[model samples]
Target: MPTGLLILLYLVAALLPLGLAWAQGLTPRPLVDELASGAGILALTVILAEFLLLGRYRFVARRLGTDIVMRMHQLLARGAAILALVHPFLYTTRRAPAPDWDSHRQFFVTADFSALWPGIIAWLLLPALVLMAIGRSTLGFRYETWRMLHGLGAALIAGFAVLHALRAGRYSADPAMSIVWLALLGIALFALAYVYVLTPLVQLRRPWRVSAVTPVALKTWEVSLRPARNFPFRYHAGQFAWLNIGTNPFGLWENPFSISSAPSAGPELRFLIKELGDFTDTIGQIKPGCRAYLDGPHGHLSVTGHSAPGIALIAGGVGIAPMLATLRELHARNDPRPTALIYGNRTEEQIACRAELESIASEHGTRLTHVLSAPPKDWHGATGMVSPDLLRAHFSDPEHKRWLYVLCGPAPMLEAVEDALIELGIPSRNILSERFSYD
Candidate 1:
């Protein structure tokens, strides 16, 4: 319903002015038309961008593979950027030389700098965002660094844009226009509040203490946290949480780690994190008394969403995180659903939680298939990655649509598996892939 409304709103927004121009039979000023259209487009773009960045909305997008939503967002951002560039050029008579940062800084410090002042700052901040979005591969910027800068840069942009709009005399002059602008600003603030302020604040007021931080390997650790007080979040077997370390609410260092423990294990939340980057590597170092803020129970790549009589589970390396939850749920429910897991790793030594997986499989009557890409000479399991032929030969009724494939792994592996599945005549919708970003 919201999706339909957005489309309808966009159509109306796009056509309303043209209709007005035709109905009034007045000479339409091209610059005015452009400016108006640009404003509308900019407003919509900023709203969607803000929405996608919000925790709840972002979770929904992740679950639904909200690519269409993102496409709309990308389109709007590009259009807004173009319109912003053209807006100044088109209104040449009204356009003045852009003041340098030094000159503008004093005006910005003054809270009364008009609605337009905020927008001017937003305009200045947008280039960095646009560049960063395209600068992932280049610019010598790692994903983590890019993400941090993006968040900081976006906040500044939104703040500045709001200020600019409020200060700009045209929109600011009318009370109703101001109200509408304020309403949009309020919604943005609400999202930010829910993610950063309200959620964390509530959690902190009623804390969830760190239970343990145990090392699984040289670089991987399992950090468990359980509620010290009443907690409302009831996560599915495979969902994750955004853990904020060091009592820093605005730190924005939230990372999605799969709940390594089963939902049947009660309120105790577990996360197995590999020390690959700056965040996970140091997770073991966090002291027991240190306060941690959590903001999730997100990601819907769980048994709850899929209801097939049988299941094909695929994982690579640490991608087995969600499968832990899925297996647990299956075991707890006594779901006689025959499930097969093709867990892939580089070597036998790196096969994490192997015993736990085998035990669960035994208890639930689920079969475990180990695929070692680069195993030792004595390795007895499948010698290579999961291929269509291997799957077809090993599994019963392999070609049926009644079986759902839950794939979670590195992007390259997942892509290959998806391609292989398609080649074997399985429908794309029957295959679900979980995006496990170490970001």
Candidate 2:
């Protein structure tokens, strides 16, 4: 779906509870109490919808990009936490319910312990959940363990929040409002089921085997995979997949890596991975014929549908993985459009597939620039970072403004390059970028 339409749908979903409550036509409570109720309702609905963002639903990720999806998940979770944390304190209602008021429009808060405990549990856990996510790396937990904890923790919060909503909320007393909360809860549960159960079951039938693991650059390896049988997986050139090497499809040992080979390069898949600790350190140990599984083909960092007159690719370190896929795809298609690549690395030894890149550039008339931060004596190539000055020198041409710019790299480089492109009059929509890390 188009991003604007998807955003519209999200807005509709978020506000649906408030709309339903308004339709109840109950006597208006004090402004403070009504604001508290609004906050709680929005918090509940948004928390439930947050699960769908990470459910591996291609529909959401394909349009918004996985990086965008993850950022949304984080921001929305924090917002929900703030609202939930302040929900109880905002209410001006009396401790005991107003005896004469209708059950669905009580002017006083309920003091019943059973009805309040679920919200209390959710309220207490929400902050911890957000804090754990924010401090995931600092806590020094394994990626797999942290991922498992985050999923279960969010589910626990959702369950208790829903329970509190149905049992204690004034708007939820109506059958119509109760049905809405139940449906949202069902959707949240289904998102979890789809990711953990149904997706893995399907992946079991079409497995992969490691074909090659060759050192491509300093601290980086190019891992290749071939289907165990005749597998039929198709993805865009600049997309990525979560690889579960020698692990079950349902396990949490998977890590996402961009497909470094072109889709046009037959069925074999390649990933250019740099050892950055964790599971990546084991890349050199995996022998050929090791069992593997994939759970992706995600992200929206491709030039497939653009109509730009030229293409510009900016990559740093292993970020070149996806750009290489795109470059190879363009070569396979025998495209005649002008292309330029700005690849940056700390040392010359860290440049991946140098020969292949040169061959492509020579044959396809691509302009390839290699920037090194630490060049050896007598080095001739550009010696510096992929800075804004360097970008302006290469891409300041009038015609280049209409080009489609693709970026993949560490967060800092991506930010700098993207800002430079936009500052140089390139339309923001013409720039496509995918981050290599998510927390």
Report every candidate's CA lDDT: 0.65, 0.90
Please list the residue runs of candidate 2 whose C-alpha ends up more than 4 Å from where it truly belongs after superposition. Answer: 97-102, 436-439
State every prediction's TM-score relative to the real structure: 0.78, 0.96
Residue range 353-379, candidate 1, lDDT tens digits: 777789988888888999988989988
Query: What is the number of backbone collisions in each predicted candidate, taken in the order shown?
Result: 18, 0
Q: Model 2, range 1-439, lDDT digits (tens) per residue?
A: 7989999999999999999999989889899999999999999999999988893789988888888898898889999999988889998888785476456556678877888999999999899989988887899888999888888988898899989988889998888989989899899988988887898898899899999999999989999999999979899899999889988899998888999999999999999989988899999999999999998888888898888999999999999999999999999999889999999999999999999999999999999999999999978999888999999999898998999999999898889899998999999999999774555
Residue 173, model 2: Cα distance from true site in angstroms? 1.2
lDDT agreement of model 2 with the native: 0.90
What local lDDT score does residue 21 receive in model 1, on the 0 to 100 scale?
30
Stretches of candidate 1 exceeding 4 Å from the true structure: 1-27, 31-36, 43-49, 58-120, 133-149, 162-178, 230-232, 246-250, 287-290, 388-399, 436-439
